[model samples]
Target: MRISKRNLILGIIAIILIIIISILLIKQFSKDEKPDIKVDEKKQDTLIYNTNVEGIANINNIYIYGMHLNLSGEVNTTSDISSIELVLFNKSDKKRYNLEYEYIDNKVKFYLSNKINEGIYLDEILKGEYQVLLKITSSDEVIRYYSLNNNTAYSYMDYYTITRNGKNNYIEISTLSTQMVIRVTEKTLPKDVYDITIDPGHGGDDPGAVKNDIYESYINLEVALKLKKELENLGLKVKITRTGDYNPGNIAGISPYGKGGRVAIGYETKSKLFLSVHSNNLPLYPQNNGVEIYTSTNNNKQLASLIASNIVKETKINYSSKKQDKVMNGVYVRNFTTSEINTFKREAKENNYKFYETINTKTQYYYVIRETGGIITGAYVDGRNKDYSANLYYNSNIGLDGYLIEMGYITNSNDLKILLNKKNQYAIAIKNAVKEYLNITN
Candidate 1:
């Protein structure tokens, strides 16, 4: 068994090569196949570097709704940036998706909402855990940093966005740690935990749109409770603002989005959608009646038309004749007007309070609609007013898709009769709309 040194070296090399080939084959034959990253590995290596650019490049907020996401921060780098892209990097298989972004005035903004028609869609993505990061290509250096987690980004940290399809998909966007992480799993959620919240406006001390022998508060509760029951029956989890006659959040004369209040309940429940039920009143025009649904003027109007159409078709309600803030057949977006903004500005000055710059003419007048919008729809409740409680979820990126439904005017004889009588019909209409929106099937 005398062997030459060269022969022994050749044998050792062959064994090493066979082991490497076998490992490669095993990886290729594995059940799970990950999508490959197109970029060169050497170039991609720079992305994980923890370069503390601080004020120069930072992500301040991360907002999520269903599959829709909006990220905001500032990038005040002195380097000449040629391009910027949002990177969804998965550490497991080195998978990544680079998305388009907007960088203006050193302020960075990114959107993953198909409604905005600008960013990535969850449907096009693969199931995996991914970390959000910014990749800024500049003359000086390529900056890659994890989406920074801010102080107020905790509201919807545990929220999950489930999809409807041949097979179900679950998406959880978390900022529990320093960086924002998105975990996409394929599983059905639990039934007992709710994802939709229904708010019946006006309760207890404040009776909304009261009329002789008929109170709007009781009528709203009646409709909302029915709606809750129907939604649950349809296999959807539902939470109401007030199960009975008392309000959960702060009372009226204060903000509706106040702590434990109407709008706050939606965020607290981590709801994907929230509906506020109310009966309208117009003493000036007693004949004014019909259904009107309100959504944030700044957000999408898809839910508005769906719910409005269903209510009108299924119930005895008519289209609202009060067309002041009407945006469509039965939908309305009652944000602040320029005149109203001026009045508020004056009042702010007189009261020695600082007016929020976010309260422009486009800002929603109804706190239920506005404050539940999170950062996407310019929601702002930063504790300015001493008389009212601050909205805890005002700065949340994970806001509830909220709507207000004014069933009918209480002053109108015919409309009032339908409001008081056709409670089940209204509930059925809303439940149908919810099913349609969620793409739920039996």
Candidate 2:
């Protein structure tokens, strides 16, 4: 307390210096505790794929029938695919087109532009082969290219008509040229003393109607065999076109050789009549149940009626009024212009007998009836709502007298049950009808 003035001033200066130094240290410590404000300068990694070179097209299921090309496949990669198109290159012109495609079930399908209306007619297109490619483009601006290979070919050349039988028309394209054709060897017509030729419709590849596990072909064969045995027992000569699950010439329906072989057998045996046995199933109308008898021409109406009467009596099933025996006029082509008719006539000569008859005015009947000489009582139910009709007359009398018997509708639960359970009864009914027709009193 009694210190000199110089001593007090020195103490005051020392305390101020201590306070400033302490303030500076405090500020420096605060600066160190504050977090650094550094902007993030990192980027994300993206995956990119290359598709510049040719690769095995990722094609799964692709089939080319005539001019029609069916394509189906899945994209295995994770890239966003914007479009997948089929590219067709005409060998002659080297022309290309990106045909429209539809995506369904993780697959794409398209027809080459000219072959676009439902399906393209190969004959209408060029005569030579064309290069096919599948091109896929992704949202990331990458295009994947694939080359298509043809695996299936047509059996005949010079343009085989799709309507081998009297069914609908379809075009067939062969990978091989016409020069490499394999003709269906001609068959010799037979001459035996057979009174009747029984045909069990649809064998081998053609499985007519199918429901659950039941096949129409199976039922037709069963009934046909039973009838054959009955006819033999009645002391009448009988011949059945097919004895097993296979068709003649391994062809289904009335292919040139298949139908020709069967007919040749009949002609060789001198068979007086032909009859086809078939079963029915309606995909749209499962409730339809009945027995039907059909005659291709008026000449066979009585025969059809006799058989139908017996079938109803035996199976105790309702007879379809729509299936009543009648002469159906079979028009080869409907709504044809004069020029089209002339063209059709000219084309008919190049076709086989079946194809010719299909194009020309022929007896309008079920294929079996129209071509093989008989009526086809197709099973009653159909996807379309309409009355069933058959073809009646033909320009040429090549078809033999015939009738078609649709024993019962396989689509109906009750009918199918009866067809499966009471097959023998139905056979007996047909036998009785044949006996009546022959005037044989056993």
Candidate 3:
């Protein structure tokens, strides 16, 4: 159509401006906008891992223990998903890492570690502050970014140790404003800073055993404190699980494998020896007396023997009269019975967890001995047990040499008296045994 020259020029300019505005609007809408979680400082506990994708993405549980970080979530969408991955971004260095993951039936589980081509990923380059994003791609090639939240049924402070050239890089995962964040810090442990970790078993609400008026937690702590002093007197550095009357390991939950508890203390300290001092209770057989020294099957029994012998001699408490799993007069290597193994298998099946082939009748029944040994000692709990969280350091090649000591039967009159009165004697025996075994001249 014929028109005036100025009018036509103005008309083209208007059209161009209109087109540019439309393009800018489209780009703005296409950009990935992060969902606001509105994490209240006080109400952080109510926050859960829910991506603001309507009903498309919601993470149920995230198991971060030892050298692995596992996640299980649901993709509540009718459309088929092409793939799901965990995206890691380092802002300080402008680096990015795409983590491979496994997803099926709206469930996701994978390892986030420092090794390559194995369940444990050992990439030291994964350092600095990481902003974690869950990348879910649909079959239609549409991509969505989700902020991984801290609603994994409990609070957690995950420490994934990455070792290289005899040093450790602790990959700590924590939640910031309801989103998951990873911070990698290099730590150099001293040669003999921590020689032993003495655990006063069942602190706070968890009293190991109970009698007329005695609490096992109190006895354990008393003995542990004394033992700590004894070991220190011999020029050995010691770390006790808990000093106060509360459960140090039960931060957000009971005995969380990596974050809290005796296992966490043992793993974190990287101590040479881990001694869990606990009292036994046989309510039905109140006549049972004396000490029971527990050592795993694969462990060296020299320490156990020394502790048993020295404790008996020093405290004048003979070996346990019970014949179950007895290796010597006072020493025992307690393992899962056949019936217990069957029960474990059944429980795993019911709970939808992988039944560990590593666990058998010979596997240590005590979590302190078994879970502290890592993969070498068949530490198979990977956050499968609903009651206890995953043992984070369960698969580490470098772990602690753990031993559990039953001071005496708390239910027995004779044993209870010694356990309450002769805590120092028991501590001295354990200390002497450790000195002889380790050849600590100091």
Tens-digit lDDT track of model 3 for 100-162: 555566555433432311222323435565656666678899877666555554444534342
- Model 3, position 201, has a per-residue lDDT of 85
The prediction achieving the highest lDDT against the true structure is 1
What's the lDDT of the predicted structure labeled candidate 2? 0.53
TM-scores for candidates 1 onward, in order: 0.70, 0.45, 0.57
Of candidates 3 and 1, the better by TM-score? 1
Give model 2's TM-score versus the native structure.
0.45
Compared with the true structure, what per-residue lDDT tens digits does model 2 show for residues 1-442?
5999999999999999999999999999878656332211111000111123255344343332222333343433444677766543332223334545555564554434322111233323433334445567778879775554333232222222221112122223222321111112212222344567888877777778998988898999998999899887876667898898876534533341232455445444445567778888787888777777765322425456778778888888777534333233111111234566466566545542222333333333355554443211111111121122112222212234556778878888888888898888888998888777656665
How far does residue 273 in candidate 2 sit from its true spot (Å)? 1.6
Against the correct fold, how does model 1 do in TM-score?
Answer: 0.70
Once fitted onto the true fold, the runs of candidate 3 whose alpha carbons sit more than 4 angstroms away are 1-193, 383-387
Ranking by lDDT: 1, 3, 2
Candidate lDDT scores, in order, read 0.71, 0.53, 0.69
Task: Return the clash pairs for model 1, or none.
Answer: 63-397, 249-260, 249-261
Query: Total clashing residue pairs per candidate?
Result: 3, 17, 11
Top TM-score prediction, candidate number:
1
Instruction: Please give the range of 10 consecutive residues that has the lowest summed lDDT in model 3.
Output: 113-122
